[model samples]
Target chain A: MRFSALRVFREALTGHKGWTPTWRDPDPQPSYDIIIVGGGGHGLAAAYYLAKEFRRARIAVLERGWIGGGNVGRNTTIIRSNYLLDGNQPFYEFSMKLWEGLEQDFNYNAMVSQRGILNLFHTDAQRDAYTRRGNAMILHGADAELLDREQVRAMYPFLNFDHARFPIKGGLLQRRGGTARHDAVAWGYARGADEHGVDIIQNCAVTGFRIRNGRVLGVETTRGYIGALKVGIAVAGNSSTVMAMAGLRLPIESHVLQAFVTEGLKPVIDGVMTFGAGHFYVSQSDKGGLVFGGDIDGYNSYAQRGNLPVIEDVAEGGMALMPMIGRARLLRTWGGIMDMSMDGSPFIDRTPVEGLYFNGGWCYGGFKATPASGYCFAHLIARDEPHPTAVAYRLDRFRRGAMIDEKGQGAQPNLH
Target chain B: MLIPHPILGLRDAQEFTYLGDAALIDRPDGLANPEAFHDYLYLRDNPAGIHRELWFHEQGDRSWIVVTRNTVTHEILGAVLAQDVARARGRSR
Candidate 1:
C-alpha cells in the first residue's frame, strides 16, 4: 500500500489494520524475462526501473537473505557527487539528481536528506587537489564551495584545528551532498518493484549459473532452478565468487569496510565531514548518534567482520580531526564487503557469457551510486548498450589500457 | 592485531600495509600475453581459511614481509621477510 499523510491519518483513526507487508514473499517462477542477482539497493532499484522506466515485465530479484541485510543497510548512508575525473563526475551527478527525486518517484520515505558534505583538506597539496576537484564538480553542473580554515573554524569550532601533525587548513563543501536512510532505500525500491509486478525472491542463494555454449540460460539456486533469458549479477562484495561460479574472473577484490556509531547525543555535526589527513569520515545521524567510518581493512576477504587494527586506525583519524569525539562512547560497529576494483572505480558492463551481465566493483561508493547504478545497469540489460554517463564503466577498459584510475592508485583494490 | 616480525619482535598492524595474496609476488612478466597478464593480475584464490599475504612495514623497518594468516579468524600464523622468502624460492633481486 502507498504510504502518505492521509493514509497514516486514516490508519491511525482505524486501528491501522489495513497496512500490508512492504513486499510479497512469492515463490520464484520457473522462467522470467530477466533475473537480477542480489536484492540490495542496486538490484532492487534496477528491478524497479526495469519495470517502471523500461516497461519490462517478468522480472525477478533473487536475494540470498532478507532485503537490506547487506551493504545497503550497513553503510554510513552518505551520498555525494563531488568527483574530479570525467569518467566519474557526470555519472555520480546523475545519481545525485536521482537521489533528489527518489522519494517522490517511489512514493516512499527514503529520508533523502541533502544536508551537505564537506571534505577537509589539511595540506597545501590536498587543497590544490580539492581545488581541481571542486572546479571539476562545478564544470559538471554540481555545487561546490571551497572554505578556508577560518570559515571551517566558524562552522565547526570544536574540531582540532590546531593539531600539530595534521592541522585543518580548509575544506571543499558540496551543499547537495548528504546521507539518507540506507535501509529505507532498499524497502522503497522493493515496494516499488513489487507494485509494478516484479517478483522479489528472498532466501534464494545462487549456487551456479546455468550456461550452455558460453550463454547463460538460468541459475541454480538453493531454493530451486529458476530460468531466465537474461541475468544481471549485482552482488557487491561477492562479485568475484559469484562470477567465478560462471568461470569468469573479475578485476575485483572483496574487502571488509567497517562503519561505527556512537551513543546518542544532541545534534552536533551540521554535515558530513571527511578527514583530509586520513581516511575518516563522519556525520551525525537523526537519532543523535555520530556515524563514521574510515578505510577498508586492507586485505582480500569475503567475511563481514574486520580486525582490530582498522578500528584503531579509524579511531586515530577521528581523534585527530575532532578531539571532542573522545567524550563520546562508541555504541556499535559493522562491516560491509566492498567490491574494490583494480582502478578504484566501478564496473557496469556485460560479461563474456551471452545473456549474462555484471554490475559491481563499487568499493565504498556503491551506497552513493545506488540509483544511477541500477538505472544504468537496467539500461544496459534492456537495450544492450551502456548509458551515456556510464560508458567508461566497461569491463574491457583495463584490458584496453583505458582504465578510469580515479584515485591513480594503480591496480591496488585495497587502496581504492 | 600484533604481527610478530622476524626482526622487530611484535609490531602493531597499523604500522604495516596489507596486500592480499602473496601470489602477487609471482607476477608474470611481459604484456605480450594479455591472457596470462589478465590471469596473473585479476584471478586470485580468496580462501576463507589460511592465506599467504604481503604486508609492508612502511612506518617501521620499510621491509616487505610475507605473513601466513587465516582470513576467517584474523589469526597471524607467522611472518618472514618477503626478500628472504624470494631468496628461499631461489630468486635473486
Candidate 2:
C-alpha cells in the first residue's frame, strides 16, 4: 500500500514525539472549590461540567491509575437508552443525548456509532415487558421499534430462529443507540477538562479523609494531603471502601461481571444484540472483534478472573442464539467489579457528611450511564440539589421501600 | 450413543450395548461411532468433551447432574444418575 507525501513526511518525525500528559503542574493551592476522587469517566466529566456549567475554577480530579485504565476502559463500549425503569429510562436517555454530541464537545473522535441495540425476547413475559418498555420510551421521545420474528430474522439472519428450547420471539430495538470507543471517552473528557484549566492529577490515590466536626476538610493521598472545601466520591466499584475512610457507610455491594471477545472476523453481525432471557449480549466492534458480556458472579470476591461456569453459560447462550458462530475462536476474557445496589439503580446525592457526595451503585449499566452520572453528580455538587431525574435514588431508598425495583422482582441477582 | 432407560427428546438412540455392570457402554468399540457430538452427550469418546456419569433428563424431565469426567482430557468412562448410583448395587449386574 502506498500513501501520500504527508503520511511519509509525518512518519519521519515519529522519533521526536515525546510523552506528555494533558494536565501537569499547578500552584501550591492548599484547597479546591470541589475535589473529586477517582479520575474516571464520571470524575473527569463532573470536572468538565463543573467548569463549563458552573464556572468553578478551583477543581481537581485525583486518580490512582492512568486515565481510562479503570472500568471505563474495561467495558464493552455500548451506549443505549432503552431501559425498564422510570428512574433509569430518563437518565440513560440524557446520557445518550450527551453521547451524540460528545465528539464535537471534546473535539476528539469517540466513534459514537448509532448502530442501535435490540433486546431479544424468548418468553411471552419478556416480550410483553420489553414492549411496554418500548412504548414508554417512545412516549418519552426515545426512538424504538418492536421487531417481530420476521423482522428479527430479516435483520440478523445468523440467529437460530429454528431452535425450540429458546426461540427468538421478537425484540425491542432502540435505534438511537450504539457504541463508542471507551478509551476515547475517557481521553475526550480528560482533554476537555484539562483545556478548561481543571487540574487532573494522575497516579495519586486517596488513602484517607480528614474529617472534623462532621465535615470533610481534606484527603490524605499516597503523595500528600490535598485539602478541599468539598469532596465527591466517584469511585464506582470502590465506593464502599472510600466511604469507610470518611467514617460513613454507603448502601453499596460489590459484584464482578465478565466480558468476552472473539478473534477478529469480517463484519457479519450489525448492531447490538441482547438476550434478556439468558442474560447475554453481543456486538461486533468496529475493529471486527465481537464484544459480549452477561450476569455477574453471584457471590462476592474481588477476583477479576471469571469462572468456567459463566464462560460455559455465556458460550451456550451464544451458540443457542447464533449457532453458526460456534466455530469462531474466542480471543480473551475479562471482568470488572460492579458496585451493585439493591434497587438496581444509581445513587447521586449528598452523603450524611456535610461536605461529601457519592455517585455510585450503577449496576451493570454504569459504562453507558457515565455521561448522565457525571452531569447529575455535578448538578448536585454545584447547586447543592439532586438532579430531578435521580430524586428517587437516595441513600436510604432501599430501607424506605422506595427502591427503583427495575425488572420488578425486587431483589437483584447479586446484590440481594 | 444409547441409554435404554429413555431417549428423552433431543437425539435418536443408535444402540444400547451393556457392559458387565448397570452402566450403558459407549466407547471406541464395535457399536459406538463419532456422529453424535453436537447438542451434548454423556457418552465416552466425544472429541471436544466426554461427560461421564452425567445425569440427563429422562422420562421427559430430570434434575441437576452431579458427575465427574476428565478435566484435562474430556473422557467419560462411566456415568449414572446420582440418585440411582447412590442406591446402585455392587459390580456389573
| Candidate 1 positional error at A117, Å | 0.6
Query: Candidate 2 on A323-387: residue-level lDDT in tens?
Result: 87788999999987777665677889888888899998877788888888888888899988988
The DockQ of each candidate is 0.48, 0.02
Q: Estimate each model's TM-score.
A: 0.95, 0.78
* lDDT per residue (tens digit) for residues B1-93 in model 2: 223232233221121211111233222343354333210111112111233433344333453232343322323344445455544544243
Residue-level lDDT tens digits of model 1 in A68-182: 7999998999999999999999999999999999999999999999999999998999999999999999999999999999999998999998899899999999999999999
Identify the runs in model 2 with alpha carbons over 4 angstroms from their true place: A1-21, A25-28, A412-416, B1-93
